[model samples]
Target: MLSTLAMSVPADSNWINFDVPALIQNFWSATFDGLTFGAIYALVALGYTLVYGVLNLINFAHSEVFIVGCYGVFFTLSFLGFGPSVPNLDFWSIVLNLVLALVVAMVASALTAFVVERVAYKPLRKRNAPRLVFLITAIGVSFSIQYLIFLWRGPNPEVALTMFRPTPIFDVFGTIIDSQQLVIVLAAVVMMVFTDQFISRSRTGRGIRAVAQDPDTATLMGVNKERIIITTFIIGGLLAGAAALFYVMRIPSGVQYSGGFVLGVKAFAAAVLGGIGNVRGALLGGLLLGLIGNYGQILLGSSQWTDVVAFVVLVLVLLVRPEGILGTSLGRSKA
Candidate 1:
């Protein structure tokens, strides 16, 4: 074409070129960031997946539950006056603070879950309401939780500049893998392991499994459906709360409503991708989604369309496998 158009072309007519090296560098950066973000999403996704596994209902309010946990950490740290000042202490003291904050958040979120289950879901389940009814109730609970946070914080963002900061273990190349990421990853992993063990080994966990498999039969067999559902919510809530702590650490300043809505939506997508009612699927789905979103940005040098990419992937996956990566037609089953 160049030769053919030489008569019309001036000195040069060539193909467009871009900075390949820069693109490669950005891709790697995006990949790393995606992995970290994916880890966080996985933690949040666990809540959705776990509850869905047992109850067959998505806890829409789990997002706000996580935000509440974030607020719990923020307020606790605020009262301790640990902002912007590195408390000169031994490694053990720092570890203590971290553990305490994480525990508090987890406990608070678990309680929130319990309360929500009792007030919003249990009654309906007892009456044998349709799943759509539960869906509406979940949405109401989610918005109510957000409003309650707004009432407490009055639409202000929590910004702990230096306080409750995670100790950075080291740097990979130039990217800083701070203590916060480690905290989120470790806490989430521990909770996930505990949950897996509980469901697989413990008595109550067995009851929950029995309920999921066949609620009527399980009830006939002496399994208390209410107790199992409440337990599932508590576990899911605890994980969300822990995820909130690490999430806020990364984005220290954000509106209260932001976490529940945006992150919640993403985590739900992860849950569906991994197989909504499968715990392991949720983890894998969240990680995969996060990685794809982050790396896509690096490749394109923009995140303006990240949501589009996410939805597109969702659509493609659904088209290919409507039941998700690990989904089945056996109805609701234990993960």
Candidate 2:
């Protein structure tokens, strides 16, 4: 069945076609799609930034955190009796299901992240292991989670039933805005703002900042390093979970064990593009990457090249400004 579907997808004969007028005609729609996806990337990028900001270690398993959240939402909705065959749901039903899915995904991702930190990282921290050790552990944890899911769920992608049909809400400059795009973009912005404010204004945020600045000084100042580290992982997981829901909403084909790898890589690149340790930089990098990739794909007339386009942008950015658009040196993030 999968092979049949794959074969059924029309090949792009115009892969190299660069039609300026056609691109101009589809500009708004592509931009909207890009921004929506960019929001998801930004949300995932936060996980990278938050963990790196405090621990100075890249949690490569963070991608699995996102994959777990995707499965969480899928299972939650499935339990609610929403599968691929279900018809359109009522308004309140859709809302309730979405809210429940979001909560479940967040909790599941957070717990997964916490476990990864405890089992894979804490021991190394105690031994004061080198950065290479941490990197290997992260990759190991990521693969473990991926295969574990594969063993449990098999290699099939889990598809969700369409709960909310995207309807045109309005039109702008010959571009029709759909419900899904609006919800995704708005929700991402809200979550990003809340996270930024939480990190900047809250007491715990101050402690995280303090630890990021100087761990020994923070410990001497009575800040609980372990607690701060755990909190950062949890927060990162929460954002990844939110992004998972948004991702499924935008592309409901299904969730697979390996689904998060590429998107996670892109999100990581976005973190680097914006300045890895800077929170606001993640947001900027995500949106910018999204726009550039989308435009590039449209111009080139091939969706398969989107990832290539994004990486090319990343390379270009690194070559030009290694600090990222908003990134500063380590321990000097504006957050």
Candidate 3:
């Protein structure tokens, strides 16, 4: 069976290109692409970081929440009568469609996060369950949500309808920077800044921080732990939903049921790389990871090795700094 399976798998010929000069020549373009992808990873990582900061539990099913956002984009675009065959929209139409799709995706993802919290995590929390139980429950919820989507949407990848075809907005050192790339980076940065400010300055943000610091003390101080938890989940979901929209814009063919698995793992790695509970760490780690993976792929000569390269980077980083680049010591608030 192993022999047969090996024979059935096709070989990747483009796995090793050792053209250093060519790699150097395309460095700018690669960096642009990396930053764009890194921003998406950062957004997803924020979800992981935020939830972990508060609950100290890794919500493995957060990926499913992201997948829901992707589907939300798809259904919204379809409802708007946009598809592969449709012509690109006019300027105002593009803006309207994007706004609508973003709203829908955020709402869908937020709802999914709330439901997951209520159904999966809340019960365990109330019971004062062991950490192992929470981990197992998280894995179970992740699988259940993934397969449920598979049952509903089937195993096929959904193609996102392009509302606006990418047009080159500028050139950087002979590399053309397109509209989609600009949008992704700008949107991610804006969202990150907003989130950081909200957490650091807003009333609700203070509640979240207090809970992360000490749930018992926070409760005593009149912070509604349940409400704060729900808020954190909702904020994370909102970011994940926006990231999903950007992701499909970058890789339109990435809307399958299992799509979240690898991306989710990478995002988690990014969270850990940046200091899992640190908000800014997620952003920094994501961008760095993106650049590393892109450069590694170029150096290795094939996109097939991207995942391997990313994991290797993660392992190396962990070995050097187990707390992550900006991660604080355990039990300390870093967000």
| Clash counts for all predictions | 0, 0, 1
| Model 3 regions lying over 4 Å from their true place | 1-17, 329-335
Task: Note the Cα lDDT for every prediction shown.
Answer: 0.75, 0.87, 0.87
Please identify which of the two predictions, 1 or 3, would achieve the higher lDDT against the true structure: 3
Which wins on TM-score, candidate 1 or candidate 2? 2
Name every residue pair that clashes in candidate 2: none
| TM-score winner, 1 or 3 | 3
- RMSD per candidate (Å) reads 6.0, 4.6, 5.0
Give the per-residue lDDT of model 2 (tens digit) for 1-335. Answer: 44334434446763355546546867998899899999999999999998998988899999999999999988888888887764577888889999999999999899999999999999999999999999999999999999999999899888755657789999999899999999999999999989888888888998888898899999999999999999999999999999999988877765999999989899999999999878888898999889888988876656876888889989988999988988643356555
A best-first ranking of the candidates according to their TM-score comes to 2, 3, 1
Task: Arrange candidates by lDDT, descending.
Answer: 2, 3, 1
- Per-model TM-score on C-alpha atoms: 0.86, 0.93, 0.93
- Model 3: lowest-lDDT 10 consecutive positions: 1-10
Ten contiguous residues with the weakest lDDT in model 2: 1-10
